[model samples]
Target: MSMRLQGRKAVVTGAASGIGAAVAARLAADGAQVFTADIQGEVDFVADLTGTDANTRLVAKANARMGGLDIVVPCAGISTFHPLEGHDDAYFQRVLDVNLIAVFRLVREAAAHLKAHGAGRIVTIGSTTSTYGDEGLCAYSASKHAVLGLTKSIAAELGPFGVTATCVQPGAIDTPMTAPAFDQMPEYRTFWEGKAPLRRLGKPEDIADVVAFLCSEDARFVSGHGLWVDGGAMVRH
Candidate 1:
């Protein structure tokens, strides 16, 4: 069996479902000691990441559970598909709080342990929306863009300490988070399919496989890269 991440410890935020859950499980399958945190009850740890103390405590627990931390993947975020004109201050702050600020705090807490290990990995969940914006999702696109920026900033800051950071940008993964839109507009699903040269919506596994590669030893030389796992959506057929 391939033990790419053997003996390493990983903490994944938003692990209760979707891409986060898939990443956590894949990492575990590859022999990393996985600590999956989410706001909901079903994950390994339940904590709202936006709260200062909660974010800290979750990281502390993860470090304790796995003996040490080597990898951190922040996957927590939200989306509201309203046009820019309809977006209000409160909505904007909420999106930023969960998608951007929480990731900052998670890294802040997890970095020390990762640095101690040297050759640490920090992977953030970004999106193709940051590259190609949809009309009704200005806020989401902005948040994802910031996430890519954050990933780069941290990569630059932590590289000297042997910690490398990268962002994975996914497109149209079939998850509960997208269930509402899929149900509301069948045409929307068709749009995603037609737009993708692969002629299919992304599965969580599709994104998870790339993430697993990023965290592996083979990726030690890569940093500050935004790897897109979008089923050829970013390209023309």
Candidate 2:
């Protein structure tokens, strides 16, 4: 509806479904040309970002497909439950690979193009657990915290280049990434629903709306921050 992002070129990962899909759609609706990648499904490019060359290749492909990169949103993430005891190193590393390293490599690859453009936006995804630890989400929480830190550093370094970096921390979003946990522990759904003053689980589009504003000139002066799109759960919790 609003052509706020007209002529902007962007890259979005994990765009086949869930939050990534919502973000890509929102950016497109705002008039940005979006190139999307996912591990599976029908997207512009299929990339397993956890692999060594995939992240770099995805960035190059997106840049080529879109013409120039002005926005970067890395939304691909995975989480599996395991309490501290006997949580294998391999499992923890996998979470880090998907959630943290993927973003890092992609952002690193996109940095030059964004800086060249002189008005770039980088919106990374974080989680409510970014600031604290959850029982079985140790790896997820750690990776998210590190993502927040990485976004902060990016903002500080890129602000002078007219680039903005921010993180969106969503709380208890009802997405495919979260469905397994909520399904296995139905109580989580009830608790999160009751915790928020809004009394609802988040929708992917809710976070997407904020991301659109951040990518647009409306939020030109906002950067280096983490926004909680949690339906007010953080305040209530």
Candidate 3:
């Protein structure tokens, strides 16, 4: 395997499963020392990222694990899909808390350490829903759109310090995150396959490969870009 991430130290949240878990494995394969934290011991540290104390503990564990930090990937998120009529304020808050706000909190805590290292990378997982809206995914779409904003702002703010941030907005990758839709609304497969140029649901490796590039020297000049791994679904839809 290529050692593109050798000597790099990174932390990935929501790493117990789904994209976060795939990213953790990919980063490790690329030679980065990855500290993965979730609500349970599915990977590395077992800490929930929704609270202040837990966020602090996650970062501390990452620092201790790698001896320093050079990369931060905030992949923890939840989707609260509801129609406007049924959606409540409390539900919206919880969605924002997990998907958008928690990511910001993690970055705020990790910023100083990343800045100190220089050439640090931040890759946040966004969604194609942000680019193309659906009836039931209002909250999720809005939250992910916020991630794009965070990515661009961070890239602009931290460029002078040799740090960069980018968002990887993916389409329907066949992960646990999408399993419910696949099982409950099997019709989604037809729409996705018919419109996407690739004619297949994305695999975790499809996105993981791009993340690897973003964290490597090859993407040194690239920042503030929301690279899509949607197999042209965004364009066709």
Candidate 4:
């Protein structure tokens, strides 16, 4: 690694496993001091994103641990495999709370610290579903779509402070979150593989690489953009 993020401080949510873990490790490898947060994991900060005060408290703790904040990646999310007819208010609300609302709260809470850094980066994890709807993922898709709006709004408001906010839309990455869908419908895996031009499912590191770039000084001019790291899956859509 080139240590592009040397001397930077970062906080990665859902850092116990999957894409979150990959991002945390990659940022650290790039020489950033990373503070990890997750509900269930041996992380630097443990808290449920659904809680009202979790985002605020988490940022405070990360700032204290790292002496400052430069990067924030809100990667915690949940999904339910229920069709619209079967979707209940509670289920729908839960998905939005974690995937969408939590991102909003985290960014809002960390904005001041990030703005103070003068080159702070906020990279959110969206999904291919952010642009295209998927069956049995009504709530999940809705939440992701909202994430784009949130990122752009933040970018607009924070740009003057030298803070950049962007979102990454990932395709079918081989992560624990999507394992159940793959297991239930083996063909789902094959379908995702062929959907992308690369003809293979994505890996967590794939998304992490893009994140690292966005956080680097080289990406200072790139803000309010939703970079699709989906192996051309959106083209097939």
- Each candidate's number of clashing pairs is 0, 0, 0, 0
What lDDT tens digits, residue by residue, belong to model 1 across residues 72-168? 9998888857878868988988888899999999999988998999989999999997667778887788889999999999999999999999999
Alpha-carbon error at 153 in model 2, in Å? 0.3
Candidate 3 C-alpha error for residue 233, in Å: 0.7
Off by over 4 Å in 2: none
Model 1 deviation from native, Cα RMSD in Å: 1.3
The pairs that clash in candidate 2 are none
Tens digits of per-residue lDDT for model 2 on 1-237? 799999999899999999999999999999999999999998999969988888788878888787889999999999888999999999999999999999999999999999999999999999988876689889999999999999999999999999999999999899998899899999989999999999999999999999999999999999998999999888865
Give the clash total for candidate 2: 0
Expressed as tens digits, the lDDT of each residue in 7-42 for candidate 4 is 999999999999999999999999999999999988
**Candidate 3, residues 87-143: lDDT per residue as tens digits?**
988888888888888899888888989899989999999888756678888789889
TM-scores of all predicted structures: 0.97, 0.98, 0.96, 0.98
The candidate with the higher TM-score, 2 or 4, is: 4
- Which sequence of candidate numbers ranks them by lDDT, best first? 2, 4, 1, 3
Q: lDDT of candidate 4? A: 0.93
RMSD (Cα, Å) for all candidates, in order, is 1.3, 0.9, 1.1, 0.7
Local error of candidate 2 at residue 87 (angstroms): 0.8
> For model 1, what is the error of residue 17's alpha carbon versus the real structure, in angstroms, after optimal superposition?
0.7
